[model samples]
Target: MPFLTSPVLPEGTLSRRPQPDIPAAAGLLLRPWRPEDAPAVHAAFQDPVLHQWHVRSSESEEEAAGWIEGWRSEWARECDAQWAVVHADTGELRGRAALREIRLRDGVAEVAYWTVARARGQGVARHATDALVRWAFQEIGFNRLELMHATANEASCRVATKTGFAVEGTRRRALLHPDGWHDMHLHARLRGD
Candidate 1:
């Protein structure tokens, strides 16, 4: 039996993960994570709000370092990209943004983000997400990108909408958490949308 071949992408289309720092609006910057950021990452995960939505917390700096290392491995494998969202002037780690479930054959990926407690109420998530989506579409050549969040997470919903990801639909009881099953809202944006 013959199998259909995957379409060929243009040469030099994100063959490797990009390493350049991306500057976004509102004085935010997206850059690769470093080991020194572990402390900040650990602290950010301690926020009760983050735990409520994300359902996981880093118990120690070491665990946070491991998480950052995992992102490096994913980048090397060309399967995911993670960046630390920081303030350009102060170089403070405000949050994180990532593109996961990257399917090069299908030209699709999913975006996820979280902001630290101090960064809450600011537009860090929105700016970082918008920058990442632009990079994924223009530089990585992804034709479609997706963002999903717990249906009850209004803040995340706002970020998704601000970045131009339209709500596609809902997945009933799709995510399991310590509290219970959660319905997730699916949002997406196409290459030109």
Candidate 2:
């Protein structure tokens, strides 16, 4: 079928929360954020890496709880889906992986992720990202998925590459940070890729 003739998602298909639990590779699990995870979530956001790259952090447990609550509303609106990356054996919160900027009509979305301090260098982000990308392409029928990170975030760049995203190009001064504007590396993968 031609591009324009390709069928898009049915109406109401993305207007509610999706199945909350998804199993991932390397004994990782992706599930919706829970209220009880506030403490861990707050602690994870305290990592300086999150502050340096993400430019935002939850200062307190209450703030983290609010962040967790916001994910449910975002799911209801179909704008994003955020999952808690957890260890299967210990059930510990390892990180987060999300598909944001979901445009059902265009079959495109953006993937983003962050790892807890203790989970760094453990392939937590890469495994969770790969699993989410696969689910987005196969289950959600997204044609294209994007992963953009500050050019200085070498670790995230590696995760994107490992998850089969190709570095398409750089968007200069595309992201604002606490320090200043930073160039962003744009990576993407298609369903056929």
Candidate 3:
């Protein structure tokens, strides 16, 4: 399939809009990324497990700090919204949640997330994802949200299913992973439909 590009996403997706920090779940909070959180974010992503699971680049503390600057700029400009997950009890930074591919034409956006392995199996991701969807629909006025996972990621698929994201279909050779092209399972949720 052709790439689903939307002018609404790039033109004014984050243009001078107010995006308030919101809590994601009961045990975890989802808020904007902060400069102080850079060290912890770097440390969390340093785990080999997280890198392997998400297939993202390994970064040093300095690199993480630089990336945090990008998130800050987006938040300040209202371009792309990103959130950091923190444990309510210990205040430990657990992971990240983001709303990307935001398109106002269809009233939809794509959601993405990743968490430290230590935080897995505790429903941290599920809580963050569900809460993000709720906020996106209710507050952001988005009518739909999509999540895509690699076929090999059963845990992600499980979370998508558990959160009422329907398995829309599969796109063969859709994503270029570290190894090669891989199929992706598409999941979707609609607002008040």
Instruction: Give RMSD to native, each candidate.
Output: 1.8, 2.6, 4.1
lDDT of 1 by residue, 23-68 (tens): 9989999999999999999999889898899878899999999999
What do the candidate models score in CA lDDT, each in turn? Answer: 0.88, 0.88, 0.79
Cα deviation at 4, candidate 1, in Å, is: 3.3
Best by lDDT: 2
Candidate 2: tens digits of C-alpha lDDT, residues 1-193: 4675654654455664465678898899998888998999999988888999997888899999998999867877778889999998888999999999988777888999999999899999989998898888887788899999999999999999999999999999999999999999999999989
TM-score of each: 0.94, 0.94, 0.86
Sort order, lDDT high to low:
2, 1, 3
Clashes of 2: 0
- Poorest 10 consecutive residues by lDDT, candidate 3: 6-15
> At residue 73, what lDDT does model 3 achieve?
75
Model 1, total clashes? 0
Q: Which stretches of candidate 1 lie over 4 Å from their true place?
A: 1-5, 8-18
